[model samples]
Target: MKFKVVEKFTSINGEGPLAGQLVVFIRFAGCNLNCSYCDTKWANKDNVCYDFMTSNDIYKYIKSTEIRNVTLTGGEPLLQEGIIELLELLSKDRSLHVEIETNGSIPLNEFGHIENPPSFTMDYKLPCSNMEDKMDLNNFHGLSPRDTVKFVCGTMEDVQKSKLIIDTYELSDKTNVYISPVFGQIDLEKIVGFMVYNKMNGINLQIQLHKIIWDQNKRGV
Candidate 1:
């Protein structure tokens, strides 16, 4: 199977609980949803960095990076058919920690059954993204404690909606939940204040560390 690889580089795992670990990032092209706050708009566009390659090619390239941690990200990585095959190949190496970052709109039951399921960072798009209507809440049941659900909020309204979902799913008790502010859109101070006022527990706030170290718009870093 051929994978539409838009960018391949190494960087720190930028969000969720695994924020500081170094990782080899394989950013695939194509997505089913368009979020207003999306930073990788270049990868979301048509004909983006059209370098089609196979899973072995990706595996070989990843080995050359000499990094043990691997992350599969995307405009929406799962939208590509080869991702499962690629993931299967990558997961064979028990030494490498494989993680798959996916928007919550897609079904995840398959991954749940894998022998060495890659740890998941599933994103539950909030109202501001405009694609929240497409989110499949049932995906939450597919998560193990090893997975995390992230809500990217750009406004107070988004945070409010996120709280309701959190309560409905008892997400804080279910697994790791994260509320990340859309960079430059929501103030970090405001997010912290919300957590403090509510005495929020079981959930944590995360920032994209790569953006902090390098220019937010810089690619392949």
Candidate 2:
């Protein structure tokens, strides 16, 4: 299987519950949604620093570096046609723990064919993202506790919308929910206050840890 890779490098798992762990990042090219606050807009465009790589090529890089965790991030990795084959190959080596960062627009059930499913960090776009209509809540129906739902909060409206969706779907029961402030847009404390005021449960506050630890403007970790 051929995978179009935007870039690959080693970095901390900058978001979600695994914020500080070192991991190899496999950034794929292509996305189904274009959110307004998207930082990686270049990845959505037609041409980027992309290379067509096979599963062995990716594995070799990982092995060379001795990294055990691999994050399949995007431009929505699931949108790539060869993603399942890539995941299957990655799963064979039990030493590696695979994680996928997705937009949550695609149905997780569609990936049922992948024998050993990787943990998913699913982003549920809110109103502030200007892509609310694109999210499909049914996709969260069968998500396991190992999977997480991340909401990028750019504005108060986004936070409110996220709360409604979280409650409506009863997401707190099956998975961990995360409310991450849009990098550089809103104050983290303010968003945390909102979460506290609402008495929200089972939700964690997160920031882009890599941006904090390294140059914010740089790509490829």
Candidate 3:
């Protein structure tokens, strides 16, 4: 099946548990929700030029890179049709460690039964994002240690809400949970203080390393 591919490039995993690791990123176009801090807004616009590549073509491109880590990002990669086929094709390659960076509004259950399913780095859009109501809480039930639930906080309210979600779901017991500040919007120290005060044992704090390493507005990493 063909997919709308905005860009494909080799880069280090900028966020999540795989940070700093070499990866091949396949960025698809379009999204259902618009977060206040979305960096890839350019990719989500309807007129963005993109290539139409089949699952086999994408699989071959990843093989050419010879990079073991593959990150399927987006404008919400899950919004694409025929994504399951692509995931299945990628899973057949034993050498690849696939990860999908998903916006949390989508359901994860459909993806769970895939053989050797790709790990997910999901966003739990905090209130500051203005898209919190769109999140599908059921997705939390499908997480495992191989997955990550990330909260991008811009205020103390957002941090408190993140803590409530974490404790309510016991997300740390089910998966890797991370809290990061909205780039340039909140002080990192504030998030640290909340974590320290709450004794957030299993949560990790991260920054978008790519933004620090390169022009934050630059594409293709």
Candidate 4:
């Protein structure tokens, strides 16, 4: 089976708990949701040019690299066909730490069947994203403690909603929780203050480390 791979490169883990770590990023093409601040709109367009490669081919390329941590990112990696096999192939590497970045809508049960299931970096879109209703909160219950649940907030309302989601899902206790600002908007100081005021010691405030290192709009590191 083959995948429509947008691009693959080595870059610092820009978000989540893995931020600042060097890792190989495999960004797959296509996404089901359209967020207001989506950085990779090119990935969502079906007409965009892409390299079609099989999972084995990808694994071989990664095997050649010195880095063992691989982030299977998207345009919603879950939406791509034959993705399970791709993930399965990549996970076969005992030294590799496979992380899947997904918009929380997709079902994760299929990953459970995988012998070496990848840790999920699940994003719960907030009100400002206009895709909050698309989230499947029920899916959070199935995630293991090793997975990370992130919320990208652009406004104070989004921050409020993030807190509610954590409480409702008991996310901080279940998995690693992160609340990141939307690039330019929603300054870190404001979000940090909100978190501190609310006694949210368990949750973390994160930013796009890659954007800070490179340009915010730059793709492929």
Candidate 5:
């Protein structure tokens, strides 16, 4: 099976729990949601260049990197049909720790039936994203403790939306939850204080480490 690819390269995890860890990122092309502040629009659906390679070809690239952790990111990797086959092949290499970053709109059950499931980094879009209606709350229910739910907030409204999602689903009991301010949009200190004053529990503040280290607008990390 083959898939459309935007780019692939070695970079630090850049977000969530694994931030700062070395990783090989395979960025698939295409996404259903078009968030207002999306930084990687260049990698979105319209710009995809087909990378017609077998799963083995991708595995070979990973093997050559000498990096054991692989991040299957996107333009929403789940939008591709061959993703399951690719994950199956990657799972054979027991030494590799696979991570899948998703937008948390599509149902995880659609992809989670694979023999070996990768650790998931699911982003729950807030109201400011403009794609909030696309979210399927059922997606959050499918997460295992190995997964994390992230909220990318740009305003107090966004934070309130995130809090509502967290409380509505009782997400804290299932897995790690994180709230991150949109890079350069909201003041970090304000977000931290808001979280504190609201008594929001079981949530960690995340920052885009890659943006801090490299050009914020650059692609391929």
Candidate 6:
């Protein structure tokens, strides 16, 4: 089966635990949700131009890079028709570390059990995104420490909601939890103060390093 790939490039991961580290990014086309602060909205369009490549084609391109880190991103990589096949192919290479930057709406149960499954940087859409209701809470049931649950805060309410979800699910102990602001929308000092007041010990505050290193709107990074 052919996957609709929007672009492929080598760059430093801008978010998650792998931030600032070199990684091969294979961005697929299309998505199931649209968030207000989405930076990659161009790639999510149904009419977006893309290359029809088989799983092997993607694997070959990744191997050619000789980079150990491979990030299967989107539009929503999991939304691709044959993503599990692609993941399985990549897993055959023991040297490569794979991660999927997925929107939290999709269920992770099947993906989590795949052979040599890729690490997940799952987003837990907060109140501001207007997509929080779409999140699949069941996804949290199978997350390991290798996985991450990110909350993109755009307001004080988002921050408070993130804390509630973190505590309710005991996410800090189950998986890595991060609180990232919506770029220019939220104040870092307020987030820090809230964290301090609540003593949010295990959660992290992540910034998009790529956006800082390069133009925030520039693609193919």
Best lDDT goes to which candidate?
3
Ten consecutive residues with minimal summed lDDT in candidate 1? 110-119
Q: Which ten residues in a row have the lowest lDDT in candidate 6?
A: 108-117
**Global fold similarity of model 1 (TM-score):** 0.96
Error of 6 at 172 (Å): 0.4
Residue pairs clashing in model 6 are none
lDDT string for model 1 (11-124, tens) is 888887778988999999889989989888889889676688899999999899899988899888988985788888887888888888899988988766567879888999
Residue-level lDDT tens digits of model 3 in 110-167: 9888888999999999999999999999999989999999999988899999999999
What lDDT does model 4 reach?
Answer: 0.88
Against the hidden reference, what TM-scores do the models get? Answer: 0.96, 0.95, 0.98, 0.97, 0.95, 0.98
* Residue 53 lDDT (model 5): 61
Q: Which stretches of candidate 4 lie over 4 Å from their true place?
A: none
> Model 4: number of clashes?
0
Q: Which residue pairs of candidate 2 clash?
A: none
TM-score of 5: 0.95
Candidate with the larger TM-score of 3 and 4: 3
lDDT of model number 6: 0.92
Off by over 4 Å in 2: none
Residue 24 of model 1, lDDT score = 93
- The candidate 2 region of ten consecutive residues with least summed lDDT is 108-117
How accurate locally, in lDDT, is each candidate?
0.87, 0.86, 0.93, 0.88, 0.86, 0.92
